[model samples]
Target: MKPSLRPSLPLLLAAAVMLSLAMGLRQSLGLFMAPATRDLGIAVAEFTFAIAVQNLGWGLLQPFAGAAASRWGFRPVLLAGVLSYLAGLAVMALAQGGFSLLVGAGLLIGIGLACTGSGMALAVAARPVPAALRSSALGIVSAAGSVGALLAAPIGQVLAEGWGWRAGVWGFLLLGLAMIPAAWIAGRVDRVPIPALAPGESPRMAVALGRAMSHTPFLVMAGAYFVCGLQLVFLTTHLPSYLALCEQDPMLSAKALGMIGGFNVLGSLFFGWAGGRWNKGALLGGIYLVRSLVLGLYFAWAPTEASTMVFAAIMGFLWLGVAPLVSGLVVEMFGLRFQAMIQGLAFMSHQFGSFLGAFGGGVLFDLNGDYVLAWKLGVGMGLVAGAVQVAYALRGAAPPAAERPAAA
Candidate 1:
């Protein structure tokens, strides 16, 4: 059957809500790091280690989750993710030390994120829409995903300040309950038939994986994606601490994160529209380039409230914009049949960078008592990666031989 030209509103809404909740809660967890560590009597490095583990676990399990969704359908996988999220938050709220933190925030939430995050949610959004509208649709969902952060950051910050860090996690738990229904609604995408494969294309997942692995452009794109993970995770995990170290008001971090979430909506929409008209690969590179420049500018000077908010806005606009570009590229290069799994493979690289950003930053801070070296390293790497991505994307390479249909 030919895919519908218009998107399925119900599916899009459901996917968007699920993504929003998953991302919002996950991003805001950083706010709890300072207070939670203090109250629980753990070192900053120990707390960050759990977050590092979360990134690693999410990365490691992502491909498997995608494959499971492809085989069993999105509903079961999504529902399982919701339960895990709830359980993870519960453990986090009641935790007494690092072990509980690791099990709750690291293991369970990581497992939950693998199922509920962008890979699975975008894959669901990509179905039922025609190719022409896929990028825009994915963008819309990604924008919605930012909403959670907007609300969660401020709320978590307030609750943590007023009641305690545990209350803040409990707040997150309450927000997570909403995802159950969203998952059920998004699951409807499973009913949409997969697009018919081209002649000579194999239905097997391994074929798609191998084709992607051998594709030069895909490899380069995936490599550049590592920087995206590194830079973003560093900010999310450490920005609050960084701001606190500057002796800024506690609420400043919340405001900055909220600004990022708010601006992310506009950025996602603009990029989604642009991805349809421009080269998605080049657009991804530009976002990285601009983001690195912004990072350098913000960190070079002492942060004021005005500068911090401005930085957050700029960063937010560049944030999550990659979702549409990357998802669209995956579909354009490979096919929808294995989009989740293929994207997951690329995301593994991203997670590795995230691990470094979270754990590495914490270690650097403990060693130096400052974030100077960490930000410098992130800026340097981002510049190189972004430049390479832009240059390589302009090359306009053809799809790998395996992806092209053989002569009959």
Candidate 2:
């Protein structure tokens, strides 16, 4: 909020380190679903619901988190997030049933992620830097966060195998402690001008929220992002269990996740690079279409070790690349002033999709004893999401004025 506060390399580094720790821990939770559920004497449905709630919390709170950071300070919010996540891990370790799980995993960690994860990282890091170098700075921040993927799954697998899921959780908690200092270092924000409309003019915050809600292009974009959430959460949460059901080698599941993390580095870099040359919306549409095709390939073939690895690589390539495009498109459509709020709404749609995918997958599997139908549903949604993005691309960009809200 201090427009006078300068952005520095230390701030970027702090954001990067915080992101890596927060996301790394969140990504590793899927590996714990089975072990945790069994040990807690809970059904998969209840357990997954807790995680689903976490996603919803993360999405729902994103805008407010950004706003809080803007008004107060990014450091305080980031510090709160670190404490929240640590508390959630501690509670989850001791949780015995649904209530504790929901509160710990669902509420605490979800809000924690809101404060510490990419949304805050981008908003905080981008604010301090000059506009000219902003894009590269954002790119570095994104890459730093993605590195967490490479670390979490494999380490979780190893720790869960060697010690216990609780031990793994504790280890992650210790790791999260590192983020406290990183977030501290990166918490400074350089404030920018706030516009005051003329008499009879609508407030900018009201307009920004309204515009994001009402704009057809943003609506379609949000819908497409929903598919991203659904696909990712389902795979991350259920892939290991799904592999077990298929009687594939147990190690294959972990390896598949590990490969996803590794390959996504390339996917993120390539697609981000490509977005500059290609139409951003078109690239987004293409990524969704590619996901649908990948899902089809996955469903069409019998589950095999090789097939799973291929699926992971292909899917991972498509992973997270949507974010840069989405954020850029937001900038392309509007400017950066209310980017956090607008982008937060878009991300909310994504997390809602995550809620469905994570929670619904569990419910359907519990009822039907398989994920066949769930996978099919995800594919259908993916196709529709692809079409939505394509429609937005073809329609051409609209003026920022077209998206502004009427007076509240």
Evaluated with TM-score, which candidate comes out highest?
1
lDDT of 1 by residue, 130-181 (tens): 7768888889999998999999999999999999999999999999999999
Question: Lowest lDDT 10-mer window, candidate 1?
Answer: 399-408
Query: Estimated TM-score per prediction?
Result: 0.97, 0.90
Question: Candidate 2: where is the Cα deviation over 4 Å?
Answer: 1-8, 129-136, 191-203, 401-408
Query: Candidate 2 overall Cα lDDT vs. reference?
Result: 0.78
What are the root-mean-square deviations of the candidates from the true structure over C-alphas? 2.2, 4.1
Which has the greatest lDDT? 1
Q: Which tens-of-lDDT digit does each residue in 243-349 have in candidate 2? A: 88888876677788777777766776666566656777888998998898898779766798878988998987787677667766775555556666677888889
Residue 260 of model 1 has an lDDT of 97
